[model samples]
Target: MTRGLSRRALLGGTVGGLALTTALTGPAATTATAATAATAATKTAGAGSRRGAVGPEPYVPVAVGAGGGPAGTDRVHVLKIGPDTAHTVLVLVPGMFGAAGDFRLLARDLVAAVPGVQVWAFDRREENLADRTGFATPDPAGYYLDGHYRSQDPTAAAYTAGWGLARTLDDLDTVVRMAACGGRRRVVLGGHSWGATTAMTYAAWDFDGRPGYRDLAALVVVDGGVRGAFKGTGQPVSDSPEQVRERLAAIDGGAVFDMTLSGVGLGSRAESTQIWYQLAGWYAHHDPAGRSVLQPRLPDALRPSSPLTNAGLLGTLVDVGFGWPNDISVHSGHLADADADGVRGWVDTGITPMSRVAAAYAGGPQPAVWEWYWPSRLSVDLDVADPYVDTDLARSLGLRLWHAEALDTPLYAFQTSYAKGTIVSGARDVVTNSRIPYGTYETDNGMTHLDPLFADTPHNTLTRTLAPFLTALR
Candidate 1:
C-alpha cells in the first residue's frame, strides 16, 4: 500500500506549486446546506446526540470481534468529530501498515467543511504480539514478519485466531454497524491504498444473500483500484504465471522486498533505516513547523531537531514497515513512490552512514524491540492472490470477490495520473460488470503516494472533488 504539512509554509510551496485548496464556492455552500438540512431532519426524527456541545469528541475504543460479550483484545477505535445529531457518518479505513492516526487531518478537514456530516476514522485491530516478536517463524528478527497475521498458540493466543480476508470483511461489517448507531445513520465507506481494497471488497461482499455493507451510501477510493486490476482480459498481469507463482511463494515464505533505495541492494531493516533517517531528517529541515503537525502521531525522537542518532526511534520505523523491508512492497507490485526524488533524496544525500546504522542495530534490543504494529493476516493472503484475482485468463480480468449482480452501491475514484491504470481499470470493471454508478476524479499535483495523509493541500483537492458528489447524495 502507498501512504504528507503546515498552514502557510506547508501549503504555500507544495511540490508542484499547484494550489489544490478550493474556496467554499457556490456548489460547496449548497452541499454544506444540504448536509445541515439532512442532519436537522435526523434530529427531528428522534436520534439522540452522542456528542454534547464541546470540543472534538474523544476516540472511543469499540470492541469489534468479541461482539457484546467481554472487552476483547480485537478492538476498532472510533474518533467522531462534528455535531452529535448528524445522521450521516463517513467511515474511513486506514491503508495497510497505517493506523487510524493517519486519517486525523482528513477527518478534521471533513468535519470543518461539511456542516452536519461527522467523520469516523476506523482503526482496525492489528497489533499481534506473536508477529511483532517474530514468534510466528524461527527467525525472531525477520523483517518479513512485519505484516503477517498473529499466531494462535494456546500459550500465546491473545484473543481469537489471526485475521484473514473473510474475517477482515466481517470486521468492517461490524464497524459499519457500529458507526450506524442502530441504523439511524447512513454510512459512507472510504479508504486509501490497500485500505481501498478492503473498502471495495466489503462493498462487493455477500452476507447471507445480501450486500454485506447494506448501509453503505458511497465508496471513496484514493490512489488504489487494484481490486479490478486484471479485469476484462484473459491476459496474465505478470509476464508469466510462473512468475506470479514464484512471487506468491516468496511472500508466503517471509521474503522481504526492499522498496526504499533504488538498486542499492538494501533489503533489511538496518540497511533501510540508514537511508530513512536521512529522509526524515531532510524532510524536517525543509519544513520548519511540520514537526508540530506530526508530533502527535510520530515518535518524539523522530521529530525534527532531535539528535540524529536516535536508534530506538529508527528501530520503530523498521518494525512498522516504513523503512523496514517487507513482503508488502513486492506483493502490491508498486514501490509506493519510493522511486520519486522526494523519497530517494534521503539516500542520495549520503548522510545516514552504514557504521551508525550497524551500531544502532547492534545496540538495539535482542528481539528487535517489537512495536505493536501487525497488519491483518487476510491482507497478506490477498497479496498472494492479487495476481490471479486482479486478473485471470478465464474470467478475463478484475476482481473475483463477488458477483456483479450483487453490486449496486455508488462508487467514486480519486486517482493520480501516475497510477491511471488502477483507477481506469477498476472503474471500467465496476461499471461494466455491476449496476453501480461510478465516477472518477483526478489531480496532477505530482505528489508521492503517502501525500494525502500528510499534506493539507491534497485535502483541498479532496474537498473540491467530492462537493458535487456529496451534494447529489442529499
Candidate 2:
C-alpha cells in the first residue's frame, strides 16, 4: 500500500485521546545560556557507549550552508559521531520529522563495531529554528511544564516556502563533500525511513548534469525506499501537477511549515503537538517511574484504567498491542503494569527499550529527535521525486531523478517488521532498474521500524550487517 501524503499517514494519527483544555504553568524558565551549559555538561558526561574501539566524541555539532537561500535559513546542522581520524565516513540522513540525534545509538555502535569508521548524522536546515529553552533544564518536569505552557509557535519562516527537495539535496551535497574531504576518505551515504527514500533519491539525483551516486562509495537504506512490490505504507509515487502547484501556492501564502497534527483538536493548536511529544519523551527518559501529569489529560480511551507512570504513558502511546496501529508502534511490547489498576512500569519484551526511545526524543547535545517545524514544501517535492521516475512535471519542480539508469553505487538495505519485504524489494528495483552490479538486502521481521536503530542488543542486525558492508569497502 503506497501511502499518500495524507497528514494521518505521515504522523500515524494523534497520540490517543490527547485533549488539553488548559496549559499548566511551569517554574521559572531557564535561558539559552543554561542550555549551552547543559549541553557542555552532557558532552563531558558522554552519554553513549562504544564497545571495542574508542569511538569519536558524541554530539559534535557542525554547521554548513546549503549553498544558497536566505542568509540564516540555508544553514544545515550535523551531529558528528566517531573519531575524526577515521578515513571512512558514513553520512546518515534522518527520516521526516527526524533529527541527527535519531541516529545517536546506532552511530555509536557502528563506530565501535567497524574500525576506522565514523558516522555523521545529518539534520535538516529547519532544525536551526527549534527553541531549546525546554531542553536547557535538567529536570524532566521542568522541561515538560515549560514546553507545555510557555513554548511559542512562531509564524512559519517565509524563506521555508522554497525549502523543497532541490535545496535539501544541495545541503546534503555540501555535507557529503565535506565528509569526503577532497577524496581523501571513503564516504557512504545512508538514511532511515523517509531518509532511506532520500538516499535512494540522491543516488539517482541530477546535480548540474552529474549523477549523485558518483560521490558515494556505497548506499544504505534502513526501513524505507522509493520503489517496491509491496507498496505498503511508504511514500507515494507521484502527485498531480495541479496538486503540486496548489501546495506550492499554499506555501507561498504563508503555510510553509506543518505545526499541527491532523486529527486531534489540541494538536491542531499551534505548537501543542510538538510540545506534547517533547514533554512525553523527557518524562519517559528522566522520570520513567514518576507519576505522569499527561495521563489525566488524556481521554479514557487512550488513558490507562489506573494511573500511569511517565514511561507507561509513553508506552501506551507508542507500543504495539496497546490499541495503537502497528505502523506507529516503535517497539514490539507494552509497558509492565499496563493492565494493572496501579501505576504502570516498563517490561523488556521489545527490541527498542523505552529508555532509548525516550532519549531519542528527550535529546542531548544535538537538537531534539523530532523536527518542530517540518517544511511543508519538502513533502510536495518528495511525492514527485521519491519514486526516481523522471517526468516533465518533476523537471518543472526542480526534482531531478534523471540518473536512475546511471547509478553505479553498491547498495545494502535492511527492513524492519513494519515494512516487511517492501524495503528490500525497493532495493531490488533500484538494482534492477539501474542494472547495478552489486546489492544486498535483509529483513528482520521480528523488529519494529525503529528497532534497527534503538535495539538494546549486542547483536543488532543493522549494526552487524552495516559494519561488515562498510568494512569491506576499506
Candidate 3:
C-alpha cells in the first residue's frame, strides 16, 4: 500500500497542491468550466445518439524540434488531443516500439473525463524514419506481403548512433517546455513501459544544473519504472563501465537500431519485424473473419496448428499464452471458431478487446501505434542510469539520475500482472528515496502490460485512477 489522495478526495476537489493556487480564475475559470461541461454533455448524449455526434477532432500532429541529426531526426512529433486553450496538459510518452497513436483512445477518454485538460502523445525522434507507404496504400496487406516476401530490411540510419537517452531527454524537454507555456499551465508528464522509465528518468534528469522535477506538477508511470537489467527480461543490464562501452561500440560498428519480435523466424533473410506486426494489425482490423495471408508464411514452429482468421493470427502473435515473447505480448485470450469453421477467430480473455487492439495498431496516420525504428542505444543508456544505484558506467555514458533523492513532485504508479510486483516495488523505492509527500501505487493483477491503454473506457483502471489524480492536481 502507498499513501496519497483518495479517489473520492481527488474527484471531489478536496485535495490541494501548488497547482490549485495557480489554477484558472474568475472569467477564465467560468469559460473553461462551461466549455468542459458542454464537452461532457456532448459525450454523454453521443453515447445514446444514433447519429453519434463526432467525438473530439482527430489528434493533430505537430512537429517540434531545432532540426538536428540526419534528415532532422531530432524532430519530435506530438499528436495533440483536445483544445489547445485548456490550461492543464498531460504529456504522454509511449513505450518501446510504440508511437503517438498508441495513446489515441486513452487521450480521447482523458480529454472527455477531465475538464480543461489536453493530452499530447509524443513519438520519439526515431519515428521519423518509419516507412508508412505500405500502411498508406489501398491494399496494405498486399503491399506489406510484397515487402515481406522480398525480405526488405529497414534502413540502417547510422545517425541513430547518437540517439541515446541524452538525446531523447533533450527532445522530451523541448516538448515539455512547449506544453508548459512558460509556467502558465500545469503539466503532468507520464509514460508507459520504456516510456515510463523515460518519465521517471526525465523527472530526475539534470538539465544544465536545473533539476527535471521542477518543470512539472506531478508524474505518472503506467506499468514501467526504473529497475536493474537483472530484474527484467530481454535486455541485459550493464554492470560495469566495460560492458557499457562494449554495447556502445557495437552500435558504432553498424549494429541495427530497430528491434525484432522474438520467437518468429523469417528464415535467414533480414526483414523488418516491426512491419510484420503492423501488417498483422492491419489485417486484424480490416478483415477479421477473412483467412490470414501471413500465417501460411510463418514457420511451422510458430504458426497455429490449424488455419486461422486474420484476427486469430494477430491474437496468436500478441496474446499471452501463445509463447510469443513477453515484450510483444499485449493481451490474454484464446482462439475461437475452432470446431465449427474453416478458419478460427480470437476471443479476448483479458481486459482489452481484440478490436480495440486492432484499431490502435491500424487506425493512425504516419507513425501509427508502432515504432518501427526503436533505437537500441536508448536501451543501453537506460541500463546505465538505473535510478536505484549509481555506477561509474553512468558517468561514462553521460547519464544523470542525481535528483531522485530530492524530487518533490507527487507520483502515481499503476502496474499490471505482467511484471509480478516488481513494477510497484520500483515505484515504492522512488517515493521512499525521494521522501515524496504524495504518491499512489496501484496494481491490477487482472490486466496485461498493454491492457491499461486498450481496455474499454469507464471500466479502465488506468483512466479511473488517472482522471482523479489529474483532477486533484488542478
lDDT by residue (278-336, candidate 1, tens digit) is 33222222221122222233323333222112221222232212332221111110001
Tens-digit lDDT track of model 2 for 1-474: 012234564343444323210110111122222223223323322343323225344554445555344455556777787889889999999876777877877888887778899899998887766666656666544555444434334353576777788888888998898999999988899998778878878888888987899999999988877765226655344478788888888778788775434333335543455556667777777666667867776544345555566766776666654534444456634444332234445554556666666776777625666676677788788777656788898889888888888888889999877655777887898898885779988877777666776776464788878888898888
Off by over 4 Å in 2: 1-63, 66-71, 138-156, 228-230, 234-238, 259-266, 269-271, 297-301, 338-341
Which structure is stronger by lDDT: 1 or 3?
3
Clashes, model 1: 11
Model 1: residues with Cα > 4 Å off, grouped in runs: 1-54, 66-72, 128-161, 227-372, 384-400, 457-459
Name the lDDT of candidate 2.
0.67
Which candidate, 1 or 2, would have the higher TM-score against the true structure? Answer: 2
CA lDDT of every candidate: 0.43, 0.67, 0.67
| Every model's TM-score | 0.56, 0.83, 0.81
Count clashes in each candidate, considering only residues at least 3 apart in sequence or on different chains: 11, 4, 0
lDDT of 3 by residue, 70-119 (tens): 56564778888788888998999998777887787788778778989988
